[model samples]
Target: MLVDIHNHILPGLDDGPESLEEALLLAETAVANGITHVIATPHHRNRKYDNPALAVKLAAKSLNEELLKQSIPLHILCGQETYFYNEMLQDLDGNLMTLGESGKYLLLELPTNYFPAFIFDILLELQFSGYIPIIVHPERCEFLKRDRQLCYELVRRGALFQINASTLVGENGLTMQRFAKHLIKHNLVHFIASDAHHYKNRPFLIKSAYKYIQKKFSSQYVTYFMENAKHVLEGSVLQPIPPISFKKNSTKH
Candidate 1:
């Protein structure tokens, strides 16, 4: 099954759909795109939005019920896209929700403009605490984009990287798209999620992105990403290959 690990499909939780109608519409779009399952990752502990685990679970349950009523062949699972904070370990130990409620993977977002000096330390702590920190949208982060070695180190340190589908397609911009492709070519990307907020603006583009991956890379690469998503949902250990290095001489400019 095609599973989206990062998405904001729940209503009134964060910067996603505003009402039940919008949520249902996004569900329909996802189903049509051949996505069978999605994790409703509402923002948590961000300065603007803070959706706790229990509340996100309740919202996901309600959305699932509505999808059933509407006959939408899509399932919504509970999760949260938590911003990195000093108290993250404490929060996860307390009541923070991990991706798909599996407790094996946590969707983490870093600050956009700067990479915190303690990021590696936090990631190590998270790994020691038995949670795999999946860094969301590394291609879009200015710091990682500038320093590819940092991304490589994070992956080597047991942290997984998730690339937004839009970033792969240049929907965000060419620079992000280039970095997304760079990560994929080096086997640094473990998951490809929609990070979708709306149907029109930031819709689920997994199908198209996979198609692009198959054509540009190989069918095996597509399977690798899909299988990683499945493993994440099942809370099983992911099979990550050693990442290849991107030679600077191959760049055009």
Candidate 2:
């Protein structure tokens, strides 16, 4: 009943699995982890490669064909991990980098360092342009470490947050794990994704994380995150929650 909103399961396109075999392995791992659905989010803003709209559509088609051939029951959707650069606005405005699964939700990936001032301004611009921006892996972004309020403000400004399951499982780093816990405790996170690239380093861990959260938080919150993800798959707009401020030290609290 869970859906992974971010992943690199597409074969040979990005830094994900290099072959269909690997992709299938990762897909099975995701399914084993209770992920009923996953979004194939490839790198769209890599200048070395062109992730045009048509190209992504084609990749989705190809991936579907492979999945069908392998008979994997997990449903897969299409999306892009968009780089938050100045030119991203142009691509989005022109309809290239827009969200693929829900069509209204675009996944915005910030640089690992402190968020450039322009990243915030441009996210606002995208919202003004009528697109819901899903901030990918906000916990892993070093910018959040610099100023957690920036993250809370993003949620305040009506942006959605997607934390990777790896962060919660402590597969990333201690700081990221702390941030993920903080985000979840404050209810600042709306979705959790695999952001998974491999079956080993980043095996899908939703099942374990689900048990963890369900034990700590209410099952209804777990349902909220999982169901909200399904809403994305069905192309439904997520019901927005009024943003809450961060405690700055929710990790320790």
Candidate 3:
């Protein structure tokens, strides 16, 4: 069962599908791409979107019902792609939605251009509070690209990383593809998810991404990512392999 840990397939949630009809098309696209399960990670606390946990859960429940009614063969789990904020920890008791509603894993999105100084402290606090933070799309962050050591430290501090399938399959660009592969070689990335927004434009590419991983890396690497996604959905404890520092001369495109 291919489980996507990140996606925005719920209607009227964020920049995802505009209506239920569009969201169903996106779900069908996922099923065709070999995804059996997906976490409907609507954007929350991302300044522009404000999807509370209850609302997200209700939306996911409705979508799942519709899928069953229409025989879509896809399941939608409740989750949120929450932006890092100052009071994130405090908000956990209230409206924050964890991945799969597991409470053990949180899919966190950081600022694209800069890495905040307080992020490390927040990650540590989250760990101490019993939630493992999965940093979403670190490969796309400018600061992480400039300082790979920071990403290494984030994993060292118990934060797992998820890269987009688009990054792995070169849909985003060659530069991002290389960086995604670099992260994989150094054991920095733990999960590969679609992050799919539209049924046509930003559709799921997990099948091709895993195929690329199998070809470039190995089948074992593909299995590792696939298994990790299952463990995350089950809320199982995951002790990721320590990330090695990115040596300047060691990487090749």
> 1-253, model 2: which lDDT tens digit per residue?
6778788888888888889789889989987887777778888775654566666777778877887888887776778887777766677545365554455788878778766787668778877877788889887676686677777888888789988877877778778887777777777889877888998877788877777778777788778888878777776778856666766633342
List ranges where model 3 is wrong by over 4 Å. 247-253
Model 1 C-alpha lDDT per residue in residues 59-124, reported as the tens digit of each score: 999999999998999999989999998878888765697888788999999999987989888988
What RMSD value applies to candidate 1?
1.8
Model 1 local distance difference test score: 0.88
Error of model 2, residue 197, in angstroms: 0.6
Per-residue lDDT of 236 in model 1: 92
TM-score of each: 0.96, 0.90, 0.96
lDDT comparison, 2 vs 3, better candidate: 3
Q: Which stretches of candidate 1 lie over 4 Å from their true place?
A: 246-253
C-alpha lDDT of all candidate models, in order:
0.88, 0.77, 0.90
lDDT for residue 3 in candidate 2, whole number 0-100: 77
